[model samples]
Target: MAFGKWVKQCFESVVDPDKENEVAELTQLLQAGIKERKRSFVLAEVLQDRVYKQRHLDQARNGIYQRYLARAWADGRVQESELEILSWVSKCLDIPPQTLRAINLETARPKFAEALAKAMDDGIISDLEAAELTEIARAGGLSLPNFVEKFFHIEGEQFLRGIFAAAIADDHSAVDVLEQLVATAAKLGLSRKVVVEAIRPQAVQYIEHVLADAKEDDILTSQEESTIRQLIETFELPIAVQVYIDEELRELRLLTDIKNGKLPSIAAPPGVNLKAGELMHYHGDAVWQFLRLLKSGPDITEHPGVLAITDSRLIFRSLTRSGAFGFGTIVAHDSSRGVIEVQRQAKPVQRFICHDQSRIPAAIFLSALRMANQTLTSQDDKRRSRHIPRDIRQRVWQRYSGRCAECNAGEYLEFDHIVPVAKGGSNSDVNVQLLCRNCNLKKSDKI
Candidate 1:
């Protein structure tokens, strides 16, 4: 037979006739009775002792007696209706109505009436149901308030339904709904912990909905999806954490190129100036080192050159190698001070070298050197009294469009020594100039 049929048969066979009759009556009352009416009837039945007495019945009665007694004592009078109800219950139950009245003379007041009213409103419970519950409570030696609290605690279907409603209304994002549910439970004076525990499955369902929506919407790219899935599998992180990891990874990749050799290198453009006789420098030691290290290993052959410059600070591109770039600066001077400084001053401020030597034509370097010399000559003119070379000055004048090369404010300009006479430049036209006073001062011998 089916499970329900089997259960019904077992119950019918095991339960005594009196108990079965009581159950049948309760079922009928529960099926038809309104909340408050049923609760009143249940309370009447409890007082009448329709249910069997247990060792804990006296303890349970003590609480009910105290509550009613306190109210009677406070009013300095007992309502005749309440007294009649108490009397009827006492006579039927074989308890002393006089004893209850005596207690009321000292203390009595309802403590959980409001809670009982609410429980009645929720369909999971009713007055007749509470009467049945009271039987169990009395048998367990629990007061009415304590019994009601425990009953609500163990039955959380209503709480779960509320959580489900909130979750559905909020696009099925469980965290948001759960937070509201927690606050609501607290405000309603429900057991927050028990409610939360009961609603956990519903919350999980909502979380699944959120994740499903995200996936269906393609909010995460293929790579992001893969990464998130991996994180979820490996770490078993919550959905929120998985989303966070995906976002973080995406941001990092946006700021960097991860594919090997994919990043372009900085190149010295044609005709740019370089200081002649000054040793030229190239910064690519990190790339080279990475290449060597990766080549030495068995896993890979090449790595991408990851290098960039920001605010004059050189940033090396990340590589799968073991070491960072080395910096070396070269200087050229008269034999007396011919020295080069080789030290790691952080990293290159800018990357100007190509990894593929074949791509760097010789003409590019030559042009760069010429540009560098022009820059140096311009500097020399400012620091000495000797005139700049006519050829150099002509170029300078042309560069400044025949205006004063120094201030760019005066026409009919002169060539002034960028280096002073004491610094040993010639006094000839090569070292002299026709200049406006502002240009002369502004272009004082200082490079």
Candidate 2:
């Protein structure tokens, strides 16, 4: 009946491996003692000192005590459960969930605790606040202490101030002001990681605000916003964020243009045929006019003599004796002048321009026209055409023995324009020479 005598009997019962019922009875007794005493340490020490099977008794004491605490926390009132969990947590590294809630509610630990207490006392934080904070902390991968410290350090005081100020002014969106505070911190060079760490404790609320703002502003498409968020996870700086935004914007523009029929939908190979997505290298007024006509629906019947065939730019030309369309180079004419004149090719050949076919597109063709007009206006001297014809390109390739001039690599040979198209060189024979794609791209406009 006495504590000492009862403990002695329990110790004996615990160590007797053959006495299964006695061992079970001893465990129950030990658990009852721990619950009644409400002291695990005392129970542990008593088992260690007085029990016959010291190790087994000690194990039973700790295990039963922990189970008791866990059950009580799970079943009892939240406050009582939290107190018990905290007590156990203080003695060990892993705190129970109830204890974590208690710690979150505590306004006494340090800076964060003090701030939280003030906010709660001022009615700044509602009942929902604790749950929000907990969720945020879990999402941010921050411990309770770390989450509190970072949140208070970053925006806690400012947020309280904003809330009080907003309440006084009768503004409903007090939360928006707090978000602006966080954005201001970001702009002021607060590391994204730091902001993320601080925000995780209030992740749900922060996310709601983000979604609302996105909807209100209509600043980013859903895809763009998702990409931004992903990039934010990887890169947490403003510059990196801006770079991604710019890239997304450009892609969006391209997609929109393609969708609206401003840009073609099909992919056309570069060189002769003008397809929607193809790159053209030629620059000339005639080519520009041709591209414009193609983009605008043309009445193929108007040009009865015009023929459609593969591998030729002269779709419409005067017919020959054969019923099949004859292939010939058709000269471009200036209708306004009522005269036949040599067609001026777009100058300063674009090394890598989008192609409709081998021909230039309307957009780039227009750019060349503007450049040419500007050039003519600026200079009083007679304009001399500077182009390299195909014959010259072949001759140059023959001169180089069909090998790279610099490296003598012979697998792929191409015609290289010595003067870049941007600089007003033409695709004529005199200005062009043969080089491999590698050498051509490498040489670029250097010469």
Candidate 3:
């Protein structure tokens, strides 16, 4: 057949209402590859052939039914009349109920999207709108929760998270508003798990900010405690967050106690003998290195070990080495780079470094060392001698402009020894400088 003749026949078959060959017309419609929307009406018309059913018509059946569903839902609603017509069409075409349901669901997705977009326009889905959403999903052959999980749950979760962030960012007292938002999210079919996960990050961030503010002075005052307790009651914070809070509070108390000269003591580890009066102030994993000047160059031999600091001595034990050194044998100590470096009289300078999770920070280690050394120095005598001569205090205070040398803070200022007196530093003008309490506490006894 000529191309023109075949094309002419195809048009006649489609236009004729009482066409003799319904199958041929339908075949031509499918073969011509016309867009589904344009050919769907004619396809539905021919599918009314009661005697022409075939397994080959299944694909065309699905397409035509999808078009029926899409048109019925075009106005974002499926009326009772449209539902009756759809049922008639499905029965005429012998489409399975499950297949019809699948087609409707696929067709209804866009309608759901449109409705959701409008409902979310103001960043809220009110109770009435939420009800409409449930009805839409159900009418479209989907459960509201399942549909949300498959399509809009992530977006819904993000929307709730944004509300949480904005609420907390605006003011901490917005807890009541946050509670309402959470309830609204729940009503919109978002799961409790999703809601909680959405709020967790923002809540944790707020808690951290509050903790930082409370510990700003290295002390948790009674008022700060009250505020923290209020937050806990307000949020009903999760155990993980509570654990972090407890750990931070414990560390703050420990630091405050250290600052007040109440050093913590630990029992000696196995195989390590303690002197009669020696008290263990600190113990942790450490890498001890002995410095050397070799023919090739300067070298260090590292002995990985456990190091203990005591009132009278430093003890180190390792698989390959073990030793103890009296405090009197120490020449100087420096912790400038997170490592404790000790210069010993007539012995190689040793470096103690730690890199584990429980590793001691250099500043804290120095604080412990200073507190430990106080046991050897008369605690009362050191306190009395800490008083600087008036002229020396005047010269040091003027040199730093009456501000902390370390942080430039002028409040709660105290005269600090650059080289601690226990380390043989005197109350000389050069050795004294003004440091705020916080910085001085952090500096401790490092020389």
lDDT of 2 at 278: 32
- By descending lDDT, how would the candidates be arranged? 3, 2, 1
Per-residue error (Å), model 2, residue 196 = 6.2
TM of each candidate vs. truth: 0.25, 0.29, 0.46
Query: Where does model 1 exceed 4 Å of error?
Result: 1-145, 165-176, 187-189, 220-447
Residue runs of model 3 more than 4 Å from their true location after superposition: 1-56, 172-174, 217-241, 250-447
Candidate RMSDs in Å, in order, are 27.4, 21.1, 14.5
- For candidate 3, the clash count comes to 0
lDDT of 2 by residue, 1-447 (tens): 999999978886676554555446557766565456654435445344444444454444445534544543343223444555545633432234564444433322333344355435543454455544443343333554466666555455445444434442342333444355445434223444554444432332222223222211223355545544553443343564456445534544443443233433233233334435333222222211222124566322211222222222222232321122111222222111111112324421111112222111422222223333444332212121323443554456557755666677553344455675546767665666655545664564243
lDDT of 3 by residue, 372-413 (tens): 565534433543464567567656756885567899864446
- Residue 349, model 1, lDDT: 24
- Please rank every candidate by TM-score, starting with the best: 3, 2, 1
Best by TM-score: 3
Candidate 1 global TM-score: 0.25
Which residue pairs overlap in candidate 3's backbone? none
Best by lDDT: 3
Over 1-447, each residue of candidate 1 has an lDDT whose tens digit, in order, gives: 999999986785576455544544543443243233533444455334345433234434444444444454344334556555545444433446565544432232232333344543542344455554343333233444455465555444465566455545444434445555555444334555655666655443333323322322213345444533542443344676556545534433422321211223344223222333332322333242211224456331333453332112233444453232212121211100011111233422222234423112112222233243444443234323332443554344344443444455432233454444646656554454434434564454222
